[model samples]
Target: MPDTETPAPQLLELARSLGVATEYWDWQGEHVTVPEGTVRAVLEALGVDVSTPEAVRLSAVELDERPWRRVLPPSVVVRQGARTAVPVHLPHGTSVAAWIELEDGGRRELVQQERWVEPRVVDGGQVGEASFELPADLPLGWHRLRARVGDAEPAVAALVVTPDRLTLPASVAGRRAWGVMTQLYQVRSRRSWGVGDLADLAELASWTGGDLGADFVLVNPLHAAEPVAPMEPSPYLPTTRRFVNPLYIRVEAIDEVAYMPAAQRQLLEWQAEAVQATNGDDTIDRDGAWAAKRSALETVFRLPRSPGRQIAFERYCVEQGEGLVDFATWCALAEEHGPAWTQWPEQLHDPRSAAVAEERERLADTVELHRWMQWVVDEQLATAHRRAREAGMRLGVVHDLAVGVHPEGADVWGLGPALARGVTVGAPPDPFNQQGQDWSQPPWRPDQLAELGYAPYRDMLRTVLRHAGGIRIDHVIGLFRLWWVPAGQPPTEGTYVRYDHEALVGILALEAQRSGALVVGEDLGVVEPWVRTYLEERGVLGTSILWFERQEGGVPLRPEAWRELCLASVTTHDLPPSAGYLAGEHVDLRARLELLTRPVEQERALDEADRAQVLDAVRARGLLREGAGEQEVVEALHRYLTWAPSRLLGVALADMVGDHRTVNQPGTDEEYPNWRVPLADGSGTVLLLEDVVRSRRARSLARAVRTR
Candidate 1:
């Protein structure tokens, strides 16, 4: 049991000042108090010392003095067309001047706004707080602000100007569109080397858009993973979100590989043949496929590059700049000292250390190889997007962005203290997941993020949207706040930590607008009511899964009553595919894995009740007839989603061929083959891309969705 003693007032105040919540309402509608220990742990993660009353008091004083001590805040984010004020603190009666340096090298004078508050004495000196108003017509880009107090050194801070709101692209404006969502790695084709690659994705997009008249093809995150075997399989827990995984690169698609010497080409062909043998297996062997692919890629990597190719590779390296170098360096170092940076030598732990710099030079060739791998994947990803456009996809490919990266992965190794330590990002106990979930990934320190001007966040968004027509942010609620679980503690013992949603969302919209991409937030579970409205106000679509759309008393909401600004779907990747869900396969699997919190019989009874309600709803909506089977119910559910006024509708590919197996079972890892199951048909037979394109059942489901 947690301590029930009242927390010290100073401790609570310090926690609040650091954005840590002392209490939050749980799913059961009970006001659960966060233990003082939990609060202190979270504060310490944020670099605050609150171990004792004196420490808490000192921390609170520092928090209060921070803004006044600095000439300006670390960074200021303002929406375009809004006259924003920047606060400046200086000695009483000191004259101040401020100016803005535009992103394009232009300068503009800012006017000092009127003072609205009285001065206060701090640290034996009176400090007056003043405001300066930025030009309302400032352009949308990153700018700089320079503030000068009379005869004092000028202080500079980052200024980010964002668009008021993101708007839909011309192709999708005022139009209802539909798309197909799939686990890209599971959708194999004859040409792929075991796992589905960019070529396979392009082929699917082309066929669906050109033949089925679909507007987009949404796929799982293609984020980078470990370079060696024993790789992390879940796409949600990637090594780096900014770079594409080389595992998804179709080796033969590279032009240089096509022009390889005959002997090398033959060896590559043999390696490809060996990998392709796994294509028919029910489980995806990522390790086996990568081992073979890596060998072939090395052969190509060693070949002399043509003058044109050499110039292009150098250009890409230059464009990527220091970020690419840091990532590539981490990759090379990981290969030498193993994947976890913490286990490596202390001298190589810090990315900026002199030893690390010398290591980069010593392992220059290995670093270049990692860089080349990224370039290969980048080119193939671009080709896939181009193919989607050529095949008449309105919005083309919609990419998924995972919530966070692995704690011991490249991003953490490179990002350093920007990511919190000791505590992991997770969720408190919720209705569906009674035990709560610890994601095991570090959360970004809000203060550190602001101090760095949110460059890391912006960079991630830019990379994800590079070749995507749209992007889905998994666990989108995290943008506003994250539940922080202390190390060695259960997720239920976590507390909410608030972030500057204004700045985060503003920057998100700005990046989406600049990229001409649509944004969709996966706000399906436990989201605040205002968050949906907030996202809609910014033209970001919310996710509405069919089974979870309910009114008061748990009755399913009518399709017409669903939110218009949403991506309506019959099922999501997290849940069982529609077919298996209707048949209660998830219940049986959970029971077998011992993942059920309640008795099996009781859980089954509840699942049956839920299924019956959904069936009745479908019948009432005229989507299903009496005694409809699982296959019919699957079609009806998708058809029902089409009736929604949502701007975007998504059809899961698993439902098309009537695959009953779940793609992922959240609570279980090795007990269930998560992220390894290949796409299959109703009979549990693995289905290749060619088989899917020609399947009559797939065509039937596509027709039902398109008929609307």
Candidate 2:
């Protein structure tokens, strides 16, 4: 923990110093008086020099007590070509400001700014209403209306200004809703030797949509990772969120592959064999995988760039100019300076300095190489999405947008001031992770992001949604509140920092609306209950993990009570596969690495009981027969998960393949093998595509998808 004793005061001071609202403050109970000296002391502790009256004046703008989510409501509708009236409910003692802006550069400019809309003095829950009017002179295109109340983030929605207010698409407004969340590289593929590539994704669409009746296939983040050894295994910490990872591209699936030279085609086959051999077990080597793909792409790059490929590349470059250039520059810097740019020479390190541009020009080939790779990734992903749509899928491809980027990544380098320099994003201590977890990624500067009109965020969303029908925002609470650990502080010693949640959700809604994409928030752990309600109201889905789907206030919720606004799952990548959890493989895996906090015997004893109880409960629920075998247990669990009320469901690839280990473990990095775990059969040989498809468990899962 930091030397500073009072975190709340210091946190409030920090927010005040930054001219942002603080979510909480220290006030003597019912006093209506706060110590000015206490506030000053807090400011000093956070390293703010606030002696002057101007500083005090700024800080005096009463610290905001409400959470960001409370301030921001979800969506609203408006009529076209008329001054429309709409009444919206607000929280107790809330203040609302209403305004509208047309697509054609016209603004209504907070016309009825900051009107206090107090709730009626009722005995039950608080609720009140405020009325706002829309602009009459709006164009036929989409318009936006915004209303803000208190510390709540503003509520925003796009108004379809048309002659007729027709109902929205069935995928958006009706019952045909479901999206798949896949780890693209980890999918059980047929064509490509081992890892799932764009071709496999295309195949999955045919299988899921045609055979299993899935609406969408949501994949894990396919964003580009830093292309070097000891690569970060987690897709969330990508080198560039704006670009796709080329490692996911199938060289053999390229349209111009037939025209490749004989030597190159043979090399491709050889590389494919090597890839298969490399991932022949229940582990994946991302570095090795990327190296093999890079070698093959180099061969392809050596040949003439196809006209169609060149045109697509040009279009992408135009769409992503500065971001792409900056990302390529960061990639080049990583090559020379290593992953951490802070270790580089001062002149070459600064992202905006002319020296960096000079360095980029000097290493032009490397930069363009990164660009070419992204273009290919984009093309293949787009093709996969097209295939899913053609297969009659409701929601084509759902992509994952990680909460943050690697601190030494393109996003941080490009949006320098938009990220806090000495802070890291992490979670507070919870039951699962007692000491808490620091993700080692930088959180966006809320004020700076808002000031820049959220361009970086908007662009990142636009890029990720390019070929996605839906997106799962991992750790979605970061949009409203992020647990920020100051540099050199332990993970537990962090403050709940707030953001412009209304603007964030508004931007999300706007983008999702424009792209015709659904939004899902991974809103688990320590989240305020209302966050789910807010997300649901905005058409954003929530994640419902089986382990955490308990009734509020510590009671275990019945499976049937699971909310419809969730993507229910038996296990997540961070946790063990269902079979592994049932068999106590997690305890064994942890024990192997000396990661167990308790004594080995004690841990094993606990695991035995937990495992037995879960199995017994399942059997009692008629999911399993008494004394069922391990295979029987697996089948029963699948049936139980399918019965969940969540509209969308995810079956982890590891579970599907019966792999005991997880793709990632929270704490230990090298202490245990982390992300190298592959999808394999029980015999330990790489489960070939044919073998996986033929498995009993796979058949059962397929049946669940087709029937339920």
Candidate 3:
């Protein structure tokens, strides 16, 4: 199904105009031309008419005339202190006046600049372009630029002036901040429902900050999954990234639970008892746990709310506006007709249709329940942040932002045209993953985002950052470009689609500055070198792992050589803990999952050499002895992290407890227990949050990372 034939010149030109790459160098340093079929398919997903040559020419004509058709450009994003020139198009000899409405209700008139470009005929009329100088002193906030030509209604577009670089929060302004990185679902406490909950998060943050002197607790993305059984286990493959998962709710902690009648209390207690019994299992049982918890949540939802609580809930609903309503509507619809909107009745497929509106009114009660759940999640998360801060945590909870949403999820159903259809986001072939990867999540269409002024992206950021002190953007490179793998095609057949990074990243910086939250971009894998520099310049930190930080000759890079603006860690969630890595558990696990490209022994030997080289560096740096024990070596690895000048240090909770099991493996889906591994040590003993706090090994590793 992949057409390797080169595209015609006109097709190539149109592709380039649409930000599609015709050719790119792979991670293996080989020039690979993107399949022509892939390019055409991606264009089709972006709403281009590419069914025939005639259609292609018509699409190209539309693209060429797009700017001329606009009175003002869709949006203008500029850094504070930088003057920008924006173009305005109008019919020949038509006079216009343009001005900027500042965020604080202030106004500034735009100065027109003369340009000599020839007019072009668009839609049977010759259109001329004029340039306007946007002032350098424009304040940093979301503003509006307005223009009126020939006494017509004023044309307007968004005007955003973002900070050149984000300002660091007080806690991390002048010193390094170290904290625990963990999968919150696997971090069950004694009091949580089978899986970890917000209550567990608060307790962990409080203990880590109060006793361990940690600054923040970085957890996996707690994004919402399906509202029914067989829910997705991987947090990264969530239904929506903008909202919190209701699965993490602590049923007993809800205020209404305390006020329930005796019969209701007995019923909820039964549900809680059923779910809590699975807490000590070897693997996380999300479906079974969610079933019990969902029933309990339904019981809680039925309880009456006090007038004050009702007012707060209503206020939250009003503040969230339409996005919240639509998300809740999706949830109710999913419960009735299943999560996949594609399989729903054809009339209901269009979320904005009259059919959906009628359905929304019919399911208003269920929609209200979902909305209330989000409000409860907000309250509980706010409580966690408060507890962390009260315990002296500098940054408190640093949430994760997953790259994209599920194909049939809420965002895909709601964000309609903003995201491209029929293509999924993934990676091109690389040495590590020879077959490449297909993450079945639709990517945002850059052109549509500009047309819509990026409202969906901005709103998602605001919601996530509301209760978080920081956000780790998974695959932040996606803000610049993404690999678009067309449906029914392998990932290797995909091509890159460039986004307007200057606009996307600038908005992120603006949002982070407003929230007073730190931004860390996961800059791993094959990245364009300047992307890292750009992110750093925007006050976004980068991620650095111990094993991946190697020189061209394959020697371990010294900690001193690491970037100052990074989160340096010995191991991440994808790999086993430091102890397991030393023992080659990742290689063996890969072998078991059949993910290895070579023989197990060969992979194991290569892995050993890599580990030995790192340990040798650790010894040379005076952090370890010639014959250190496993625990000592693990602690020394963390000590190696402390040697880096990086502003942030992350010590995995798994490593603190000598966990040999990895929570996730990159290449394996169902073959490996990815995202299901409970918090455990080398002997396969499941450990609780409290168990981690009391462990001597955990305490020693914490001290090692804390050492300056």
Candidate 2 per-residue lDDT over residues 269-385, each given as its tens digit: 888888767555566677777788888887777677668778977898887888888888888778877877777888876778999989999989888888877787888888999
Q: Quantify how close model 3 is to the true structure by its C-alpha RMSD in Å.
A: 1.4
Task: Give lDDT per model, in order.
Answer: 0.89, 0.68, 0.90
TM for every model, in the order presented, reads: 0.98, 0.80, 0.98
What would the per-residue lDDT of candidate 3 be over residues 1-708, giving only the tens digit for each residue? 568899888899999998999999988688888777988999999899989999999999998888899999898989999978998999988998999998999999988998767889988889998889999989999999999998899999998899999888977999999999999998898776789999999999999999999999999998999998779988998898889899998888889888999988998887777778788999898998888888888878888999999999999999999999999999999999999999999999888899999999999999999999999999999999889989999999999999899999999999899888999999876645667889989999998898888889999999889988899999999999999999998888999999999999999999998998999999888789999999998899999999999888999888899999998888887778888888888887778777666788887888888888998898988889987899999888888888889999999988888888878888667887789989987788998888988998878888888875
- With a 3 Å backbone cut-off (N, CA, C), the pairs that clash in candidate 1 are none
Tens digit of per-residue lDDT, candidate 1, span 356-463:
999999999999999999888988999999999899999999999998899999999998888999999988766456678888989989999999989999999998
Superior by TM-score: candidate 2 or candidate 3: 3
Q: Which stretches of candidate 1 lie over 4 Å from their true place?
A: 1-6
How many clashing residue pairs are found in candidate 1? 0
Task: Please state every model's RMSD to the true fold in angstroms.
Answer: 1.3, 8.5, 1.4
Off by over 4 Å in 2: 1-4, 7-169, 172-181, 188-194, 267-276, 306-308, 552-555, 588-617
Candidate 1, residue 554: the lDDT equals: 85
